[model samples]
Target: MHLLVTGFEPFGNDQFNASGEAVRLVPDKADGHRITKAILPVSFQRSGEVLAALLQDHQPDALICVGEAGGRDEISLEVQGANVDDARIPDNDGAQPVKQSIVRGGEDYRPATLDPEIILKALHQAGHGAYLSEDAGRFVCNRIAYLAYGQKVPALFIHVPALRPEGQKATVGAETDNREAALKAQPRTSCTLPELAEALTVVLASLADQMK
Candidate 1:
């Protein structure tokens, strides 16, 4: 089986997105199935087009799209995508769509064809923080997830926090206290890019087993 995995580029104030970094680390093969990687733009207009083209080119048996979710400590296996685009900020291409439907005539929501429970369990067993999330948010992540599902693809989205560098607390979505002398005293809840890569490997293994 050929599997398609994708991640978004750096958007917002982030210098690097863990999703894209992790996707880049995924091996070329997982559980004897070929894996194809796509580094997608954070633009609403171009993301769909890029994903559609990859789908056409690869005809992957399953699709997994990954993105950064600030403030989330765990890897989120998003279960559903709403037909809405309510961006809190403009995308990479300066597109800030408000209350827009992802697909003009698509369903109000699209449930991921992949089994979220199984994926969540795999991540847990692999010692990665993970959970089943109902909302992929009304952002680019949701748009791609809903699009893939609507097109009858076994697809889902995974959200990861910004990777924690060597000696700094991941401040992606944290409040810093001026009173604290040591930044390390602030809780560090985010994982590294390598951890995210391992998490995806676990997910792919589970998917391969399920597809069989």
Candidate 2:
């Protein structure tokens, strides 16, 4: 079996993206399945384009796309993707799409083919902060999730937090200049990059068991 894992590059004022960093941390093999790592752009346009190409090239049995959601304190296993593209900030390409349909004449929304409940359970059993998220947001993560689900592929979108060591304050980059205030408002609830990598590995093992 083969699985394709993807993550997004850093965007905006973020110093580093945990998703991409974790993707790089995933081992080449998990439960006898080969893994392919891919880094996607933080653009609404290019992310989907690149994802489609990867699906074509790898033809993996499953796809797991990861992105950074700064405010979130836990790993979110998104259940569905909305057919909207409302960006709170401009993408890397300076494109801020609002009220835009991801696919013309497509369904309003699509649920991920993967079993989110199972994944959430596995993450929890592994002692990680994991939960099922109803919204994938109107960002590139949702766009790619919608695309992959539309292709009838078993896909999942995971939102991770910024890299932060245990017990230390997590300062997230904000679209506004009030970075310090934002950090103060949002508590320091995050995990290290290695911890996230372990969570992904557990996710893979759980998926492998489910497939069997």
Candidate 3:
């Protein structure tokens, strides 16, 4: 089975993007399967073109896209994408969408059609911390998820958070009261580039089986 995976470059203020790291790491751990990777810029025009080209080139049996979700603390298996576009911050290209639907004339892509029960069971059985999540967020995460759904392929997105660095506190202060000190308190989540790559390999391998 051919698998095509994608990750995005660091967007916004983040210094590191775990999703991109995961995409880079998985192929090394995977043995004896055809896999390809595409790293994307968080731009509206570029994403669709890149995605289309990737699908065309790889002709993959399955598509998996990974992106950073900064604050999320879990391995999220995205379920659906709202016919919405609301960005709190501009993407890496410094252009935010005011009223966009990922696809111009597309309908709400619901996740109810996917066989999550099978995928979820496989993921946990493979020993990775995984869960079925509803929101892929309104950012680039949902954009690609919906595109895959539109293409009549079994596609899904996984979201990882910005890994807290070593020796940091478990929690950071909100603001205005020594945020620098609070930033110092945040504990790292152990979700490193290499670690996420290993986890993604396990997840994708299980998914490829389910595809069969």
Candidate 4:
């Protein structure tokens, strides 16, 4: 099976995005399934456009969109995407949409075709912290999930917890800047980059088995 997996670029004041870094570590193949990976922009407008183009070009058997959820300690298997763009912060392009419909006349919500229960079980068996999430948030992550569900193939969004890079010191007391504050607020619960890659591989392998 061919799987198209996507991750977002670093946004805001952060130096790295967990999703992008983890996807970069993912192998080209998992359980005999071909994995095509792409790093998407954190733009509300262009992300969807790039994803649409990717879907058209690849036409893969499944699509998995991954994003970083800073405060979350576990890997989130999103079940639905809400058709709303309410960004608390500006995207990479400085676009901060407010309570706007992703597709003006679109449904209020779109359900992910991937089975969260199967994926969750696989993640647990692999010793990864994971859970089914109803909220993908109103950021670019949710936007990609919303657009992906509109596609022809099975699709879902996965949210990974923020990981602290090796050798980075914890901030003391008051934050020196917004970047420091953001970095300090992120939970350092997940394993290293290699482990994150392994977790994603487990997900892909499980999905491949399901297809068989």
Q: Output the number of the TM-score-best candidate.
A: 4
Model 4 Cα lDDT, one tens digit per residue, 1-212: 89999998877777778788899888999978899999999999999999999989999999989987766667889899989987767888999888899999999999998888999999999899899988777878888989998888998899887675776522211111133344456455546778888889898998888778
| Cα lDDT over the full model 2 | 0.79
**Deviation of model 1 at 184, angstroms:** 22
Model 2 clashing residue pairs (backbone): none
> In model 2, which regions exceed 4 Å deviation?
164-188
TM-score of each: 0.88, 0.89, 0.82, 0.90
Residue-level lDDT for 35 in candidate 1: 97
RMSD of each: 5.5, 3.8, 5.6, 4.6
lDDT of 3 by residue, 1-212 (tens): 87888988766555556677678877733546688888977776678689998898778877888876544555667777656565655777777776567666778765633465666776677666677777665666667776766676677777765564454332311110122332343323545666677778877777677776
What's the candidate order when arranged by decreasing TM-score? 4, 2, 1, 3
Best model per lDDT: 4
State the lDDT of candidate 1 residue by residue for 116-168, as single tens digits: 89988888888999988787777787788788787766887888875656664
lDDT of each: 0.79, 0.79, 0.66, 0.82
User: Which residues of candidate 3, in runs, are more than 4 Å off?
Assistant: 28-31, 112-114, 164-190
If both were scored by lDDT, which would come out higher, candidate 1 or candidate 3? 1
Between candidates 2 and 3, the one scoring higher on lDDT is: 2
State the lDDT of candidate 2 residue by residue for 19-86, as single tens digits: 89899999999978999999999888898889989999999888889876666678888888888887
How high is the lDDT of residue 159 in model 2? 80
